[model samples]
Target: MEERNRSASLRRALTVLDHVRAHPGLTLTQLAEAVGLSKSTVLRLTAPLIEAGLLDRDRDSGLYRLGHGALRLGQAYLDTLDLRAVAAEESHRLMAEVGETVHLVVPDHPHVVYIDKVENEASVRMASRIGSRGPVHCTAVGKAILAWQPAELLTGLVLEPRTRHTITDVERLRAELAQIRRRGYAVDDRENEPEVRCVAAPIFDHQDAVAAAVSVSGLTSRITAARVRELGPLVAAAAARISSKLGSTTR
Candidate 1:
């Protein structure tokens, strides 16, 4: 019972902080109402939060707001984020969901460097490995990230043909990138590897800039046109989850 009471108190205090964060300048009465607690109970909960520097009450208006401690905590969390570490769980989940390999890649100027790979149990394994570099014009992971990059980055870019299907024409590549932006995902239908297919989506950072990409890859027989359409949203959702973990508000 003592532990239960302590847990309840901690929850109530966190509730108060959440309310203040969502609605800054909330009065004592408004906070109490928002938290569905009595004024006395709210005060009791907020007292420790204020003492801990997680909350502050205005002297002139008696309004509540988040304090410096909250900023410190948020910054601490942001500081600990590693792109590969933050994306690992989601990458594995996507591979399991799609029954295909998942790859996480980050931008390296005109190319994307693979940082992680989660493989599915199949008779055939992907030839692509971690640390491999892929061209932005022909790979799904590359196009997913490049779609969100500045136009100037695409100018004078070398669109070397990797396969017969690779987009070598600059105008056509730009058009496909525009389509990728609209669909929130990208597809590589034997453009990078002759027998491989992939669906990918961009991951964003706290600055709302494209930071990386997550992809689902498989043999052409496994990931067909219809399957690409089916996996597009799933891959995009996985990327969005990783982006959220990276503190991105934009999906």
Candidate 2:
């Protein structure tokens, strides 16, 4: 009976991953209905996969999608998967052009994790490490991914108040994300840190979902509000280049 249960659970997990991959953004109700399982059962089966990094949950909006682990696995199957290398080269060029720090981040469990960073010689040094995590509600890279995410996932995120500038109001955050989507980029005006500012844009995968975010961040003095406005398009262009390298035809 235990073995049978395990097999059934594995099947459910695979089904969920397939559905999420195909749909890009599916609500729990929608997933449950599509999988012919109860909502509770779908949630239960997905929990372990999510914990294992094979699936992702949008806490803000209660949506489920394939996670980075799945992406890694897919990349592994390919003989020539060096997008990150390409991204790093592009990031270096962007940093040289903008004279600011460029970062590449991917969504982790409840936050975005910096995967890579290239700092410009004249840019103010940052406190972030390559593996460090940042809150999704306050950072430009996080907002860039969140803005393009499914509504259900956004609604389901737990908005803990981390700081005075942290956005704790869900409705307000949703509005802000909507604006980010419409603007095609996101800005951090000391939202995450008192004297830091950033501008970010989303990187799309071949599936056209937000796979990552790339940004330019620095001290507010160097990356002032006016500078953010100026850098927004450049950041967006870099993101577009990265996305194109990843096989996104959106640009």
Candidate 3:
């Protein structure tokens, strides 16, 4: 009986997640009605999910939406599959060819998170950890992903001022994103770290959306302005090849 009850609860949780995925901005009342449960029961079930960060509640509107934790979990599940693993090999190759640290980053919440990385044997080491979060406005991988983001997603981002080098001006950031799109790559010239530089390009999915970014990073001395320019196209080409392997046809 206990096992059956647990199974039923799991099914109900899945149903709630599916419903939220279909209708992102759902009120508690609406969710309760749709799930065929009382308001109190629905709230109780959703409490753990909210605590786990799988769902979020809008304070002003009193609506529940899918949260960053859910997206991170979904991305992690995808990474464990064949696609991200295959991309990792390409990232490793790029690191080897460029003699720099190559990172694979994905958008999460208001920041970008490094999912995988490969470091060149001869390159100056970076301070980045596998699960480290980076600012979107000042990082090559972040700019690469932002350049290909939908307008709606761009609007939803909140640009906080973290450092003097951070791009806080909205119009200027947009212009920079535009340049990134046109150039097919992005360069972070010590924007995030004072003595580090990086060049990055977008990785697309089958749907041609910017699913991730690949970047090659090194110290400022090794990756000078001219070297950044030279490596930009190389990173972009590598990213494009990986995107093609993932069945992306659109630029």
Candidate 4:
């Protein structure tokens, strides 16, 4: 009986939350009617949620709505939706077009983490490991996201140097990001690894926020300065195509 009551309570809580999410700012009475629960039961259920910050009630208007805690939980769920699997076809197409290794990366604060890759036929392969972190200040994948982060977060990064050419100065990095924004792409320019270069472009979600990025990387011996210029637009195109598939209405 105790276990059955607990399960019923949990189901009720979830149903109440789902109702609140679907109809934001509903009153206590409105929620009770929507979920077919008694007003007293809703009061009991919402008390714990209000304490946990998952739900909030407006004292002035006497309405209930999801809070910051709920938003965090929703975002966590969205983050786990396999972006690599979502981007697989686009990554393969890009690999075929550029003949270089392609990476799918997401920002991990001070680093960018590789979630997936499409490898090239070349014998000299990129040293990147899937699920490994790379510096945000120098890697093309990192630069692409850095260029899209909020100004306060972008300015506060430590800009740790990985190579001689790595942009350690805030002003220099800001300038580089400006160029990236204008061109819709970013480049490593041998900053992450000796004799290696890469071009990358941001992938935006339906909210028009940079969610992740796609990068084309190769040995600098074959991926020359001229080749970088050529592949830059192609990378941006691939990223845009992937973003569209991910529900971005942006062209």
Candidate 5:
């Protein structure tokens, strides 16, 4: 009975906080009505939240609002989130839907580092490993992320040739990046590896900056140009989901 009462009190306190967060500057009476509690009970509930710095009450206006404690808690959650773990579900789903290997990579300035890979039993195994690095100029995942980055970053990039299809010309690569931004995805038609093809999309962070990219990779025999067009939107949608999970408001 004692424990049950404590749990109820905790729930009530949290409810009060939620109400204030949704309707900031709410008066004591308004908050009570919102949470379906009496004025006195709401006041008692808010006492703890106010003391803990999760809420603030305006002395002159008797209005309630969220406090710095809420910001700190939100920041703590964002800081603890791991990019690989956040993108894991979408990466696996993309691989399952496409029947190809999926890779998750993060920007490493002039390159992208593979941080995770997902594939099924019959999926074509990619040469990429979790810790391996690929040039930003030649890999689909790399180009996907670079497309959203600051334009100045492109000026300093060295467009080295990886294969005959690789875009070694800076002007052409710039045009390719523009196309990627317009289409919401990027494609590597045997540019990184002569026999491999890939389609990738950028992942955004809370600030709407490109934080990473997700890609579907397979042999040229399986992932042809037509197939890339089909997989482009699928990969982009998967990356958008991952970005949403990371607190991105805009995809």
Candidate 6:
């Protein structure tokens, strides 16, 4: 009897929490009606939740909503999702939407190592594979990660040229990183490959730190400068969505 009663009470509390989440800023009466509980019973249950910081009650408007305690629990839940699986789903979606090759990579010393990829059906596709690495100074995904790197980490890193247009100057690279930060994206216009272009954005982790990047890569003939302007936001939005799935608060 004790166990059954405790289970019932727990279910009721979870139901109330779900209702508050779905209809934020609901009143006591509104929540009671939605959950089919009496107003007094709802008040009795909410009192403890509010006191525990799981729910917030607005004094000015008499509204109730989920609080920081719920957020902490949600963040904990999201942290368990496999990162590559999440990135794979987003990469497939982005590739299908943009009709371009999409890649997921983590930054390494002077390079970014590809972990996942979704290829386009174009006759001229990018010459990259799942384990391929690209120079950090010349690849869009690398720049996306580098643009968010702390100053201490950036120091003493080599900026050797991968192509004629690869950024070998530290100050120029810093300026480009500033622009990338402002725009939430980066672009590699034939800086890594002779005629290949790429646009990418950083993927944030649970702590809102950049741990990886996502990119769309293709031949310049297809991913033209004009098309780059169109694809930048699309790739960035995809990356932001993936970061959100990874429990990043930055999105």
Which candidate has the highest lDDT of all? 1
For lDDT, candidate 3 versus 5, the one ahead is 5
Task: Write out the backbone clash pairs for model 3.
Answer: none
lDDT of 2 by residue, 157-191 (tens): 88776557778888998999989888789998888
lDDT of 4 by residue, 46-133 (tens): 8988888899999899899898898787677667766787799999999998799999999898888999988987647788889999
What would the TM-scores of all predictions be?
0.89, 0.67, 0.65, 0.67, 0.79, 0.75
Order of candidates by TM-score, top first?
Answer: 1, 5, 6, 4, 2, 3
Please, what are the lDDT tens digits per residue for candidate 6 over residues 1-251?
Answer: 99999889888988998899889988888999999999998988888888888999999998999989988887788767777888888889889898989889998867899998889776466779889888877899999999998866567878877789888888899899999999999999988888899999999987899989999999888899999999999999998998998878795
lDDT of 5 by residue, 1-251 (tens): 99999999999999889888879998998889888999999989989888888999999999999999988987998998999999988888888898999999999989899999997778666778899999998999999998998889988788888899999988999999999999999999999899999999999997888999999999999998899999999999999999999988766
TM-score, predicted candidate 2 vs. hidden true structure: 0.67
lDDT of 3 at 206: 63
Q: What lDDT would each prediction earn against the true structure?
A: 0.92, 0.86, 0.85, 0.88, 0.91, 0.88
What stretches of model 5 exceed 4 Å from their correct place? 1-52, 57-65
Task: Compose the digit string of candidate 1's lDDT tens values, residues 1-251.
Answer: 99999999999899889989889999999999999999999989989888888999999999999999999998999999999999999988888888899999999978999999999877378988899898988999999999999999988899999999999999998999999999999999999899999999999998889999999999998888998999999999999999999989895
| lDDT, residue 238, candidate 1 | 95
Candidate 5: global Cα-lDDT?
Answer: 0.91
Model 3, which residues run further than 4 Å from truth?
1-81, 161-163
lDDT of model 6, residue 2: 100
Q: What is the lDDT of residue 94 in candidate 5?
A: 86
Candidate 3 residues 1-251, lDDT tens each? 99999889888887887788778898999999998988898887788888888998899998989988898887785566565686877887888788999998888846899988888767577889998999887889998998877756667567766546678777888999999999999988777887888899999986788888899999989999999989999999989988887767865
Error of 2 at 153 (Å): 1.6
